[model samples]
Target: MIENDCSDLFVQNFSFWKHLTDTEKQFLCDNTAPVHYFKGTNVHNGNSDCIGVLLIKSGQLRTYMLSEDGRDITLYRLFGGDVCILSASCVLDAITFDVFIDAEEDTDVLLINSAAFRQLADQNIYVKCFGYQLTAARFSDVMWAMQQILFMGADKRLAIFLSDEISKSGSNEIKMTHEQIARYMGSAREVVSRMLKYFSEEGIVELYRGGIRIIDKKKLHSLI
Candidate 1:
């Protein structure tokens, strides 16, 4: 059981929290627990555990899958205040494939027990609808990632990824290694290194010891 008051946290993250009946709210509060994970810790692996819905309280989580060749490809990421329904996929019949969730940074999350949440979802229309809507939205993100891998060129994909990172962090310098970038894009590290070298040669970016800095944002966007 959660030790401190997390009612406010639930209400802020779960849109349906306010609509839940008193009994339903009580059930959730009873079953939910606060958990913390260090960076690089695997929260769930291969759908083996039903960890249930995660309401991120702080830090970030990376939801990824293993390719047939055993490469990790990121499907999506969740940050503070984001609700993660995918970690509870075992309770959702529609999701059949294996998924892995890991902490990208030290993180804290409120975990609602899968059976309890599933029970509520079955009884409450609002809860059910919220689950379905969030699942659909996450699936949309997965599809976009798949499309980028299948249709977009490496240059365009890399450009979009860098631009997105810059926008998300509000910083021109991206603190990631080429191997990390390759994993996110589901590409080979060598390919990403070659592309980055090309970008550096073209005066689009400057590669430093451990990160890349944007030299020309317009040039980067032109490739997208």
Candidate 2:
């Protein structure tokens, strides 16, 4: 069940919420469902499941794509207070490819049913505009990821990733395994291991079990 506060917050996240008619609001509330996902859960599997618009209440979600060879690359992530409209691409005419959503950690999400949302979007200009704006922003994120993979070298990418992680967590220590890092980088575990080994050898970082700590921020930035 959606808690009172969470339900309110979910409704409020929609910029058009205030403009909604009483009947429209009631329909939205009726179609929206609260769901919890355990860590590593596949919230949406490619284009196979149209789970609808997800309003994250807590935890993180990783959006990625899989290759035919069984490799996957992280596209972007949604955190608390973020709304994800890509999962409902089935209802939107713009989205063409498959995308996957996974819970990076245990998560709580308020899911607005796709059909209901599509109906709302069709009837309300404000809701449609909001969806378009969100979809554009997410596509920008996807393009950035693609640019990095296509143009940036692994060493530079890893350095930037570590730097960004430190900035986000406000800590030099990053608690993630090589496999996890590789998944984010769209590379193999061995590649990440070798890269980390090189970083350790150069005293740029210290790699311990399940984590890496930046030892030389200057040197790390130099690579980037």
Candidate 3:
């Protein structure tokens, strides 16, 4: 069984939490549970599940929407120390689209109950500040994604995405499937495959089964 001791995490996430009364502190700690997700697992469904608040402890998650034809389009990715409220659309009332959260890597999160969080937000100034800040931050991110999709071409977007991956992993090699890339970029599998083939012919990238390696970073940058 996994240990649920997140008292330390609570303090680490909100240093001002130490100023609250012992009763309040204990209540928050007791309600803040730990959840672990294996790679490729769906952590939340905005259509059905009511996610309270998920504070990532480690690893990565992808929040995305599914099209009418079942194509998955990634909205944003979350990492450690990030607070996610879009998963709990039931509580927010502003979210209209169905978003699914899937674990891209093995992940651990601090899960707070929605009702408890609401109460805490109402009673504690620090909690309220954190909640509002998180909401605004997520909203900005969604807006940025909308702008990108609306203004940027797929080829340019794909180049930028690969550049980001290269910078993050510190290597030209990217271990991702064409299907996966399609989902991330909100494009069709056939389209992504065709685009990648074009990139390969142009010497922008070297393709392999289940992966791609950047050969000419300069060419990719120019496209973006």
- Which candidate achieves the best lDDT against the true structure? 1
Candidate 1 lDDT over 65-141, as tens digits, reads 89777888888888998889988887777778878999999999999989999999898878888888899999998
Q: What local lDDT does model 3 show for residue 122?
A: 70
Which candidate leads the pack in TM-score? 1
lDDT of each: 0.90, 0.88, 0.81
C-alpha lDDT (0 to 100) for residue 71 of candidate 1: 89
* Count of residue pairs whose backbone atoms collide, per candidate: 0, 0, 0
Instruction: Report the Cα lDDT for residue 109, model 3.
Output: 92
Pairs with steric clashes in candidate 1: none
Worst 10 residues of 2 by lDDT: 1-10
- Over 1-224, each residue of candidate 3 has an lDDT whose tens digit, in order, gives 22236666666776457766777777777777889999999988757887688889998999887767777778889999887777665555445656888999999998888877777767887777776677788778778777767788878878888998999889989999988887788877887889899999999999988899999999999998
Lowest lDDT 10-residue stretch of candidate 1: 1-10
- Candidate order by TM-score, highest to lowest? 1, 2, 3
